[model samples]
Target chain A: MDTKTLCDGILDGQRRALSKAITLVESARADHRVQAAALLEALKAAQASPREALRIGLSGTPGVGKSTFIESFGMALVREGLKVAVLAVDPSSARSGGSILGDKTRMELLSREAGAFIRPSPSQTELGGVARRTREAVALCEAAGFDVVLIETVGVGQSETVVSEMSDLFVLLLAPAGGDELQGVKRGIMEMADLILVNKADGDLKAAANRTRADYAAALRLLRKRPQDPDGFPKALAISALQEDGLAQAWAEMGTLADWRRAQGHWARTRANQNRHWFMEELRLALLAQLTQAGPVRDAVARLGDSVASGTTTPALAVQSALALLHP
Target chain B: MDTKTLCDGILDGQRRALSKAITLVESARADHRVQAAALLEALKAAQASPREALRIGLSGTPGVGKSTFIESFGMALVREGLKVAVLAVDPSSARSGGSILGDKTRMELLSREAGAFIRPSPSQTELGGVARRTREAVALCEAAGFDVVLIETVGVGQSETVVSEMSDLFVLLLAPAGGDELQGVKRGIMEMADLILVNKADGDLKAAANRTRADYAAALRLLRKRPQDPDGFPKALAISALQEDGLAQAWAEMGTLADWRRAQGHWARTRANQNRHWFMEELRLALLAQLTQAGPVRDAVARLGDSVASGTTTPALAVQSALALLHP
Candidate 1:
């Protein structure tokens, strides 16, 4: 489709076209990217800006059934008549440049739902399973009218925190296992979560789940924290993804937290801060590229490193001399 | 030697000189950094290139015996007549910034030893419990012929991971009470740890310690990991820090792991990669500063973001238009 007609359809709230356009943008071909960019521009011009969707990032330990839970939880939300989009980034091949992108199969129910949009992205060895295109994909989802964007990360360290930067809510899922189970995972994930859900909370596991929740709550008291969470309060809830219990409460809790965030102006302020950081990061990449290509500095810098390595010069003097030339 | 002469004397392997120089390098003042950089250059020149040191990073959940174990471990090494430098970053300011550098006090016996250097640098809210200059301090220690440079962190979530990045071996010290205590931590730590020690394994906790180690060993089997770890095999060991039992075994395990890693070429490759990453990161920061100031693209980009917000343009197009002027 031509950019003009394609964008007009998106503005008219045609979900299918929106999906197609997002796919085009996600494609790696140079031509497709150019065409996709043009379509996005036309779409932006024609539509009144839709409400930017709420982004939530979910991360947990592997084998904790992240996809199964997202599938069930997403289906629950769709049943409530809310439009949802799920972006699942696979973390299996983070050290290597491979991704399983298995969410589509794992989340068949949600994937097949007419109102639910499920896209499984490869982390591509990104520390967080959030590829470079993720933030832009998010904008596209919002443009297409996904009220809720659920990003499911391959349960890796640091990726959840990366997702937290892009999302409005960060939910850390824990299995109903006790202190012994939680002890090896390190204290990192706990501090990042605005909400903690003890999954596998069913039948005989209820008491264990409750105890885990209480223990976590006590632990939370000791952590030096900010006043308001991305979600309104510090909430630890119990849910059974397998049994599909407490799912609605989880959804409601998310909504309440999101509302509280918006009311507190945290929603905008946080995004603004993220935007600034992202911009800085982008500029950093661009400028470095320019500097490396600009002049005699590049050659001089490389030679200097060689000298420093061979014990002929110092890294400090090399950097200083290189910077002087580049800036000059 | 006084601080002044000692700072200058660090040019040689004088312990006092090494101590004074580290303090100045880690000092927060602008003038101190200038002095530190100069001293660093001279010291780097005077010392042998790449001093042989086993740089280990120790981190765990709060209440875990990190210091207790380190002291026990350090004392074990000191008794063997190997010089040890413990850069124990103080965490007294978890809720505030004041610090007493009191880990030396925690490990009372080791603190009194002439062969051991136990200095608790303040966390001071740097990237991790590690002060920003901690890397420089580590460089200083390595230059002065310290056999091992041990970095102790505040055991916070993201901070622990960051601390692990600077060390040759990352040891995660976990408590011995192991009835499924793994739920609290995300699975990420498993990937980062070169060694896992279940501490407090003496007395009544012995059974629990064994069980915890068993659980970790089982879980590790499930992970398709790097062909080799920093500490050779993926061995889970149990140790009683209080009783000072398993010190030699633990140290041997660490040595065996390091040997395995060196045989696999990971030791050299890992450090080289880390250095490359830091260079790239520093380049990014320097580039961002220039990019924000050198081009009109910064203004154009911000304006474009506003257009996207106001429904006048799309991000894809904004990026394109902004980049077009990047050449000019």
Candidate 2:
């Protein structure tokens, strides 16, 4: 289908069209890139106003029940007549033995709901490219009338932080444990989380989950909260996806946080800053792409890099020489 | 006067020529930049290989006795027949009600010694420029036959972190403190520190210093050691700058760490990486300078930025438009 037809179908909330459009954006083909950029330009013009969707970033370790929690939480949102969409960017998905977001089997109930849409993470080599595409996917989903977009990232490496950049609210999922587990958590991720959820808070693990929540809460209190966070610091709570317990409370808190952010001017400001941040990043990436594609520039850079590595040429001079080559 | 003459004096370890050359590097005048680059190029060829210098980055909070510790440390190194040069980058020097390196008062004895050379932090507005100049200053010092370069950064803001980028060893100094104080420390900086020292261990603070030392030692144990770290994890020690206690041990440890890094070949690899990193950073800065200085590009960026802020244009599109303005 053409760009107009696909965009119209997306605006009409057609899942298949939205999926196809995402595929176009994710495609690495030169011709497809041109078409994808044109489609995005059209989409931007179609929706001149700011989007109202709540973009929530979900992150957790491999077995932290992220999929289950997201499934339950997604069902709750869909039950409220709110459309929900899930997109992931898991760089390690190939090594971890699955297509990115191949957990459609686990999200079975939500998958059956018409209001719910699940798109697996694209199996892309470049993390930045994948993240850019995922962000564009969020915009398309919003255009398709999805009021709640959940982005689940395998929170181990650099991708988790990138996911947070595109999110309105960042939620970190953790399993209940004592001792070393707390220390094992990356301090960097903890600082980025807007909310922490201790999943699997059912039966025998209930009390342990509560204790874990308290410990994280205390740890967070010690942290200097992000200036953009709402009045209170990051809050921690417990939930059980197996029993579908506390799912309502979790969903309610998400709404409350979103509302608070929107009511204050922070929501708008944050989005604007995000746009500028991405603009600079995209510029850098594009420049790098250009440099690598140009034969003479590429050869010079490699030779200069080797000289730099051997300490024969200073980096400043090397960059100057490379820039000279570019202009010449 | 001439670049060639300046190079000769610098290679001959003339302090006057070295100071003049650093001033040239720090100058914002266009002609000076050209001359500075030429001088650096000449020096690079004059010295066929990378010089071996022990670069130590020392950081501490305002009242944590950083100056006192450095003075004692510098004097001890001088007594050991080592030629020492100290450079600093303090962003808060003005608000802290002092000149950059105001501790020159406390360092009077060391200042009088012919073996020691001290350069105060330049009052540059941009932190990156200051850092760049400081890195160049280190090379100049080495060219002047200074074997030990101690970079003392006011640990309040971003300068401390930048200082770490240019150094072979990063030492974080903290005063005697309780659990709360440890929690108050920035986790990111803690991760970067190669060694942690609890200073001011004289008089009644001795017991508290030891306790703080043990606490930090345990905390450091919890952190994953950097792959570049020579052997064990970051070690914590207690020292008294007032009484000159533990000064010898601290100085000895610096040598041990530097030797370990060099023997493992990490020293050369790290310097290469740093050179590359700075090269990229310099390119970005130079590009930004050009973009802003060009009237059409600057105006276009401002207009696009305003549109992006109002949510009318996406960051990707804005960047593309700006890039077009560049080429056109």
DockQ of candidate 1 relative to the true structure: 0.16
Model 2 chain B lowest lDDT segment of ten: B285-294
Over the true interface, candidate 2 deviates by an RMSD, in Å, of 3.1
For residues A1-328, write the lDDT of model 1, one tens digit per residue: 7777667666665777766776776565547857977765665555654557779888887776677788889888888888888875554454554334455777888888888887757445544214435665676777777788988775665566667777888888887777556734557777777788888788898888888877776676666366567423567888889899888998888889888888998777788766554444433433465445645656766665555545454443444455555556
Model 2 alpha-carbon miss at residue B125, Å: 9.0
How well does each candidate superpose onto the true structure, as a TM-score?
0.61, 0.71
lDDT of 2 by residue, B1-328 (tens): 8999999998888888998998887775647767877888888889866456789998877789887887888998999999888888776555555756565676888878788888877777688778878888888888878989999887666787788889989999999989457534577788889888899898899999999999888877776677777665588899998889998888777778878878889888988887767766665565556455546667777788878767777766776787777655
- Steric collisions counted per model: 18, 0
- The lDDT leader among the candidates is 2
TM-score of 2: 0.71
Please report, as a residue range, the 10-residue window in candidate 1 chain A with the lowest summed lDDT.
A123-132
DockQ of each: 0.16, 0.29
